[model samples]
Target: MAASSGRFESAKSIEERKEQTRIARAEVLRQAKANFEKEERWKELKRLRGEDTWMLPDVNEQIEQFSKAIAMAFSRKPT
Candidate 1:
């Protein structure tokens, strides 16, 4: 009975560690995309108003893709 209890505790600890890693990774991705969006929007708005400037649509696409990836990762959690 004691051995079984120890094994159970070890397994529970591993599960918890995995959860923490997932949460941290998600937050990092969210922050990175947010920063990119802030800068991109400023440039895009300027370009839209016919300013003599340029914008990278590829960055916009990456922001969209990263957002989706974060959402999917969170959704897979064993709530």
Candidate 2:
């Protein structure tokens, strides 16, 4: 049993559509790979700089406070 809706597409058109989809997928993959590589390079550069920008000033102040607390703890004699 066949239902004739009178709409048809050639095999060549199907192949062309498949090829276009494949190309689009390849491009998306390439872009993702490029982004990953760029991020890796950025991290490497930051690592080489020996610090992660030291964070913001308030963050630095908190770190200093923690350090002071730790130092004070160590200085206290054990009961």
Candidate 3:
């Protein structure tokens, strides 16, 4: 990430924008980490579908659900 250039006007508000930015960044990273496993599963499912694996349990529905869940997760504001 690029460093914030606070070269403009001096202090006005007591609230620190840097802290808010850090919190937002951390939340985004946390969400990405939580979703990483789902992404891997989706990729694996695709790969297995490409192969001749007939004994594998059906996971296409679950993958679709995961996609929806990921969308919901990203659409909400971090609490």
**Candidate with maximal TM-score:** 2
Query: What is the lDDT for 15 in model 1?
Result: 92
Off by over 4 Å in 3: 1-15, 41-79
lDDT on C-alpha atoms for all candidate structures: 0.85, 0.90, 0.76
How much is 69 displaced in model 1, in angstroms? Answer: 42
lDDT tens digits, residues 1-79, model 3? 2346554544544347767888999999999988998888888988877753434345766776899999999999988
* Best by the lDDT measure: 2
Ranking by lDDT: 2, 1, 3
Q: Give the per-residue lDDT digits (tens) of candidate 1, residues 27-71.
A: 999999999999999889977885733446687678889999999
User: lDDT at 62 for candidate 3?
Assistant: 74
lDDT for residue 30 in candidate 2, whole number 0-100? 100
TM-score of each: 0.48, 0.60, 0.36
Candidate 2 has what TM-score? 0.60
List ranges where model 1 is wrong by over 4 Å: 1-9, 49-79
Of 1 and 3, the candidate ranking higher by TM-score: 1
